[model samples]
Target: MNTIFLLNKTKDPTLSEWYERKINDELRALGIKDVHCKAVSSEPMALEITHPLVLICSSSILRDTYSYQSAEQVYAPHAKILAIIVHEKVKFFRHRFTNLQFSPLRFIYNPHRMPLRELIFHLLSQLDIDLEVRR
Candidate 1:
């Protein structure tokens, strides 16, 4: 079974809900039947989950130093973590990339501007997962 954890720390409930529903829908479309995915608001709750995980978290959640460290400690070395930062231009994220310490990490800037399939493919690629849907 594959586990995908979406740590939504965004204050906007609407955006968080969209991410959860869209991501899960795409997973289902790809025939990931044994996949377990969830959107969690709390860091401690996410940390307690024991599985080889793929984590997608908003940068707003990690803006606080403690929150970022907690995330690094929890998901580092075990999961493929993707940090999303909303910006006007995707290139802006490059300036901030040096600060992160986590390995197996990827970045998604201005996710709203990207196609859902593209985003899903990027996440699956990071985990080296190939999905085949039987429609």
Candidate 2:
């Protein structure tokens, strides 16, 4: 089974719920029956290293003392980690430490500047899901 872990450390309940629902709906629509999409508000005890993980890169997560350590725990050889920029002012992941810490994750999606549909498409594609027969 494929798994998607959305790590959202921010306090915005409304945005978090919307992101989880929309992503889950899109994955299901793409025929991912055995997939698990979860929105986690804090660092998890353990994460499946092989699964794809989406990190909600916001000001809060960046400034958190444990964010770096938490991100390290999520890193794995086969894991596909994506950072989504939610802050309007953060046009890019240019923070000195952020660039170094999250540099391994090449896929960065900025919903504030780009299309949400595009992010979904990229996410599904990264998971190696076939979108030809979308339901």
Index of the highest-lDDT prediction? 2
lDDT of 1 by residue, 77-123 (tens): 34436554342233334555433433334344365455666666656
Q: What is the lDDT of residue 73 in candidate 2?
A: 48
Q: Which residues of candidate 2, in runs, are more than 4 Å off?
A: 28-36, 46-50, 59-80, 87-102, 133-135
Per-candidate Cα RMSD to the true structure, in Å, reads: 5.4, 5.5
* Tens-digit per-residue lDDT, 1-135, candidate 2: 777777664556566567788878876676667665777554543254446767665554445463445354444334457545453455345544333234334445555556566667666677777647443
Candidate 1 yields a Cα-based lDDT of 0.54
- TM-score: model 2 vs. ground truth: 0.60
Question: What is the clash tally of candidate 1?
Answer: 0
TM-score of each: 0.58, 0.60
